[model samples]
Target: MTPEAPPTTPTQAVEIVRSRYAQPKLPDGTPAELKVHEFDIGYLVFAVFPPRTDAAGRPQPSPPGGAKIVVSKETGETVTVPNYPTEKAIALYRKNVERNA
Candidate 1:
């Protein structure tokens, strides 16, 4: 098999994550959107969540423990981690990258 090409831009990186990871479904059985929660030069972290507002128009609290998808800009590779704060997720991704390097 051919190796995947590395992502050229942040937008491309997001696309990679979208294609590779499946968005989680809400209690209503609707698939949540993959939103870009954070990023740096090397990685883009996505949060799986429902819309910002509910049908009643109230703000939605972010779901607990939804997995975050991290995409590597250099390799177009991905890592999924438990729902963590952006900083912690990036730190874990960096550690994994280092270990694999």
Candidate 2:
């Protein structure tokens, strides 16, 4: 298959994230999925968590220490940032972009 071009839209950015990261897994080996936690025209942020209740039927909070994936809308580049506030993550992305530019 041919390589995908850099994402120019939000939907394309999402697809890139999904394809780039493998499915998330819980400590017990249960599989989880990445969900879009926040998005803007310039970046998309994804969080790793189980989509439904765990095997024991208890609600699962997202695991800590899972870095959030940020997809750049302008370049299709990706960066993993600490699982902190959304605003802070965006700021870090901007800083990285500037530093590289």
Among these predicted structures, which one has the highest TM-score? 1
lDDT of 1 at 62: 64
Model 2's TM-score against the true structure: 0.64
Q: Which ten residues in a row have the lowest lDDT in candidate 2?
A: 32-41
Candidate 1 global CA lDDT score:
0.67
Clash tally, candidates in order: 0, 0
lDDT, model 2, position 10? 57
* lDDT of every predicted structure (CA atoms): 0.67, 0.66
Off by over 4 Å in 1: 1-3, 26-31, 37-41, 48-63
Per residue, candidate 1 scores C-alpha lDDT tens digits across 29-72 of 88765566545545655655546778989998764666677766
- Our tally of clashes for model 2 stands at 0
Report per-prediction Cα RMSD to one decimal: 4.1, 4.7
Worst 10 residues of 1 by lDDT: 41-50
What's the CA error at residue 10 for candidate 2, in Å? 2.7
